[model samples]
Target: SQELEQSPQSLIVQEGKNLTINCTSSKTLYGLYWYKQKYGEGLIFLMMLQKGGEEKSHEKITAKLDEKKQQSSLHITASQPSHAGIYLCGADMSPNDMRFGAGTRLTVKP
Candidate 1:
């Protein structure tokens, strides 16, 4: 089993600004998934990575897996208030095993 550590446990950014959140793994990562959760809402699947150096983007948000497969980063461009939420990183250790980080709370100021 591997442990996931999400940096900046919380963040505050002005609207239209850019920000980044990082996730580190205690062991080599085989599969990684990024999710966002709004206040009092379920998690929304953002992106998934299975190969090293893989990158994915949706609208203003982008996610990437490092070449070493031990880290991943999520970047939000021209962030907005709508981006305020808790960002979670999950690692798929096996078919039946998955672990998640404590989650990063984002606050986008107007």
Candidate 2:
């Protein structure tokens, strides 16, 4: 089984600043998914990467997969209070094996 690890377990940024979160996997990733969730709320799917060196962006958030397919980065531009939440990176190591990082908690100061 594979496991995902996220860096900077937590972050606090002043409003309008930019931040980046990294996710690394112990095994090759077949598929990588990013999700965001607020306290006590359900996870909200943000992006998915299937190919090596692939990237995707939605609004002010961007996600990228490294060429090795074992690492991913999520960049947030112009951080806002609305962006405060826990970000999770999930990976499918095999058809039946899936794992998720502990999640990175972000806080935006006004």
Candidate 3:
């Protein structure tokens, strides 16, 4: 929304490829989150970065928050057809305020 911004609003990857998406904020982030979803489905939490310079990985996915707490990145390795979907990045500016990106649409070519 207003507090968060994401880049490269969309991406396309070939099967077995790797890709990265970035999110940025103007204010310091209290918490940063990554999510994945398919059409007609709910969001699935991928990872959360609470501290600056923090990073986490699960399976072929990895997330990182910059030391400034103003940026975050999500990386996917060896993407498959199942990886094709929408990716979202969220920022919690305060306990009462949370904003999400418009979402990056990812399409994986067979």
Q: Output the number of the TM-score-best candidate.
A: 2
Q: Write the per-residue lDDT of candidate 3 for residues 1-110, one digit (tens) a residue.
A: 45678877889888999999999999999999999988788999999999989999999999999999999999999999898899999989898889998889999999
Clashing pairs in 1: none
Ranking by TM-score: 2, 3, 1
lDDT of model 1, residue 84? 96
Candidate 1 residue spans exceeding 4 A from truth: none
TM-scores of all candidate predictions against the true structure: 0.94, 0.95, 0.95
Pairs that collide in candidate 2 are none
> Of 1 and 3, which scores higher on TM-score?
3
Candidate 1 per-residue lDDT over residues 1-110, each given as its tens digit = 22899988999999999999999986778799999998678999999998999999999999999998889999999999999999999998677779998999999999
Candidate 2, residues 45-110, lDDT tens digits: the string is 999999999999999999999999999999999999999999999999897888899999999999
Report the C-alpha displacement of residue 94, candidate 1, in angstroms.
Answer: 3.1
Give per-residue lDDT, candidate 3, residue 87: 93
- Measured with C-alpha atoms, the lDDT of residue 106 in candidate 3 is 92
Which portions of model 2 miss their true places by more than 4 Å? none
Each model's C-alpha lDDT?
A: 0.92, 0.94, 0.91
RMSD of each: 1.6, 1.5, 1.1
Which parts of model 3 have CA positions greater than 4 angstroms off? none
